[model samples]
Target: MSDPHYDREAEKYESPIPSREHILSFIQEKPRSKRQLFDLLALADEQKKAFERRLRAMVRDKQLSCNKSGVYRPFSNRGLLTGTVIANPKGFGFVALDKGGKDLRLTSQQMKLVFHGDKIRVRLLNKKLDAEIVEVLETVKTLVGRLHLDGKKPYVVVDDRRIKHNIEITELIDGCLDNQVVVVEMLSSPTIDSDAKGKISSIIGNYLDEGVEVDSAIYRHQIPAVFSEKALKESAQLPTKVIPKDKKNRIDITKLELITIDGEDSRDFDDAVYAEPTKNGWKLLVAIADVSHYVKEGSELDSESHERGNSVYFPHRVVPMLPEAISNGLCSLNPKVERLSMVCEMYIDPLGELLDYKFYSAVMLSHARLTYTQVNEMLEDKKSPLRMTFSNVTDNIDFLYGLYKTLRISRQKRGVMDFDRIESQILFDNKGKIKDIVASSRNDAHRLIEECMLMANQAAAKFLQKNNEDFLYRSHPKPTAEKVELTQKFLTAIGLTLEGGIEPESRNFAKVLKQAKGRDDENIIKTVVLRTMKQATYTPVNEGHFGLAFEDYAHFTSPIRRYPDLLVHRAIKRVLNTTSREPSGKMIEFGTHLSMTERRADDASRDVEQWLKCEYMRDKVGENFHGVISGVAGFGLFVELSEVYVEGLVSIRDLKDDYFIFDDVHHQLKGQRGGKIYRLGDMIKVKVASVNLDDRKIDFIPDFG
Candidate 1:
């Protein structure tokens, strides 16, 4: 019964069963009468009932259903079944089925009839899990955002970043000019490539004004900026602040030496930290905003948060996860006020290895709120007054700093691939217009807190793993063999070598990165090493994290912005309570959904940021900047500008001196006659020739004289 050999699955097809063996033999068998065959292989009384009961339950739950009817019956009530469109980036789409063979794949061309997120029907053509798009039932019409011209044709660049294509805009609302953003309605009448015709309905304005802030807020998170009358009414009716009556075993901890360290402009203070040297080691406390407590499950507020997924922060604006009533007020861990929190109590020894940890529902006091800039300044300056403010806690501060350094070193020794990726921030004026682009350097304060959060996350994962609990883990698998080989070649070309032999551990990559410090190509090497690694994703499987070099890891902090952390909180609470009931199948399902949602949110955020940055640079078409060759593609070479820290393409035509042919596998372009090759990480200067704000792309011409 435990092992289902070939014969068992054969029997399953004869008898109606759910999830038969996904093999050829089971699918290749001859037809049988549906009811009679099932009736023939029936088991003894209770066992028969149990099997039928499970099958019925699965069917009733809409998780499974019968597929094809037999030849014993002439009219086999089966043609094709279909549902919503799910897709992948490589341009393949799936049509959900119910006559229930398998989810069908709709080729990119077939999907040209119905865009992603459209509900459509499909016909079976090849096999189970394969089909052709038959019809589209519904298309999502109205999209929110700006109108930008593509070449000479204009396109409605929707605020929803999940939309794979930019719909062309035909009708325009007056008072909106080129590069002047506006939200538009997509006319139901189909247009270019399965997309709908669209027209500008409203102006969101230029990127810098107050109205633009609201627009940025909506554009970043895809959340409606203007609240519905009903929702706003509910907010207006609710109490402004938490009264003392809401207190549970309340004791004020607002006067303790707890401090918040974040960016200078961060308004939503979700976490506050405090630490001091203990007897055996050090005592570290991370008090995070108790958002889950305030936003109860199944409430309107809860539904809103779930839909938004998380707060979206653009370069000059923010879209909050929770409304101002909660995120910026009662639940915020601000100084001089009592705020409830869930705390992680950590113990670490002198060697910087985190020894043990526990989580608790606690209230913490913060004496001073600190910013990263201020902390960095104080650490560098001997006579800074901020050090004196921590006079009573000076030893604690020193110990914590020393511990952070030790942990960082320990992390490196364990082969943790330290990726110091540079991010560019566009400075905005009071009017919200982009004034300049600046690259923000990662400092010790940022790394210190990152290390702290990592410790907590790792400890949480270890706890769940050791307890044999059903939990979603943050995992990054080993890179593909092909990717590793490519990485080796790139590193060798860039004057760096992966140290621990041909087959090197992640630690070898880390060592190369460490040694590349102060080199001109440091960023290039770091970027290459990063690209060679696998992406971190969440799963129920404990695959381990390759980048952090941990056997197990999870996201336990940042409950405010991450749903997985909230689930972790619930899991920890369940364990603490030691209840009779454990997490059901729904718990795992929810974890999967949340993980997927988190990734979706990330993609949307990144897409919007790119669009905004590209839009900001659109007006400065002729500007020049020194740059490096970030990538070489078939079409052209990608130049990363040093001044703006933005990347654009230099089309192959621009390389006029020599006819270049793309050397595909090696990631370079060869001058066919001259034998001069342009490759990845090659430094050069470029002049921005054109910008397509709608496509969020810029064109460059290589200044090769």
Candidate 2:
């Protein structure tokens, strides 16, 4: 008496069903309705219930999903987007969209299913761009962390704060111990329901071990520490000295009395300079190491150099972009050695304007290697020991300083913004622990080299533009309108005005800085204006450099350490030969990649420096020091100690007298009950309360007592 269709469906539910693989293969070939899937799999009448259960299980596993019309398809085909997950330290995460749309935000619950840097497929849930993780496509395979043992249970707390989950350890490599820093390799990636599993690969060292801080930073940031065998082999094959054939079409400028000026610790000399007074004004020759001559394009060495983007300079060491064989051996501008170079011969008029410039390959011998301190002494005192030591080059040094002054005037007239912020240099003792932190002084020697480099960069940009070649330009965009408005409000609070209207040029900002030069708040004002500007990046497009106020600029020096400069050398070569080059699209992609690598290097360097600073301050807890308020937040003020240049938080709760309100517009924190205010650049005394090495954080309290 029941319907015949019911009888048939019931009969089908009694038959044996196909395996998941068989069903999935059928669905993958082509999407189908449930009825069609049953027919396609050729299931018996008795298999209907089993088939339905299997379909539901697949949907639950995110292998398949059903449409509104009740048609089944692969989950990836159901309008899910793929992206890399960027997790926050507070548990939330965002999917950086691959197709260049707005990022999709994931809730804490959704973020639990995947780790930071995991590539996943996501589906938007609402108009707010909130997304649900459909599937994890790829997981971060390696991590650096501290090993911990809970009784007999072992695990790793990853150094990257964004990776919220602790990795359970299944095994340990030789020499690994609890509380030691180790690198772990993921044995199993996290799923929707379970945590990740890993095995310790190698032990870096103990938490408080000497040099371990720098090692931890290196691993934490995933900076490449060693070159590949192929790259090293290529470097080894490079000639120990420049061959005679290499100089065949190169100009001979070995008698120009060129001198290399660099830091006392510098080993790789990338550039040398010489200047002389000409009939017009001056002739300057900047000879840069011809790295392109040794590291040919598309070679293994070139590939590695491009991947590095630029050399990373840390307090105690450098991660050079090229191998030592090339960077410090064959290509370094060593004194009295004939080396190949790419010279930028520039002519400047009496008014500091660039009259003309020509780029050519040449051979040169460096007369001497000079340090900044030595050169400064020679300039300040005629009878200085350095002056007597390098007597032959004293006349040339004087002329270079004269040219630098002219260039400085020109730079000021062009409205270039210069922020005179104090940079700290960490000095290490014999045991490699920090001896002291001192302010890095910049004198005329540094400025002379900088202006020379700027001129060469501008010349390169001009030459490329004239030839209509595709190349990477160093471009700095102006500040956003919101930031500009905020800056204006803050400046007005300080009784200062920003000239040139709402769309003021960089010169307007320069004027404001000039007005505050001798004021007690000069550093604070400069810091604020600097924060309101955008970071410079490499681009194929010819946007002007806003900070430098240059209409066109390109990095053409230091090819030994920067990949962009090497590429620039290649581009210049092609232009000189009148050869057709690659299209602009390719250069644009390369520019974007190089810019990211540059930032990667910077982040790694900064991470190491922070860790070192934290270690240096660990012993100073309970001590009092003078500090300046460097940053203000809703929760606290960040005070940078004047003695050690280390910054720590002064929590709002410690203010004690009243509830404080953060003023975003004026960049200050005001107390409601006490009517007290703490603003940026306020000099105050503070006592260090505690240091947390685990979080690399320090806490401070005002010395009100």
Leading candidate by lDDT: 2
Inter-residue clash pairs, candidate 2: 11-45, 11-46, 12-45, 12-46, 12-47, 12-48, 13-46, 14-46, 15-46
Residue 300 of model 2, lDDT score = 91
The list of candidate 1 runs beyond 4 A from truth reads 1-111, 119-131, 145-255, 389-394, 465-471, 495-505
Alpha-carbon lDDT of model 2 = 0.86
- Please state every model's RMSD to the true fold in angstroms: 13.1, 6.2
RMSD of model 1, in Å?
Answer: 13.1
lDDT of all predictions, in order shown? Answer: 0.68, 0.86
Query: For each predicted model, how many residue pairs clash, with residues at least 3 apart or on different chains?
Result: 5, 9
Worst 10 residues of 2 by lDDT: 1-10
Where is the poorest 10-residue window by lDDT in model 1?
Answer: 68-77
Model 2, 56-139: lDDT tens digits are: 778768788654345676777468899999898888999998887889998887777788889988877668888877778898
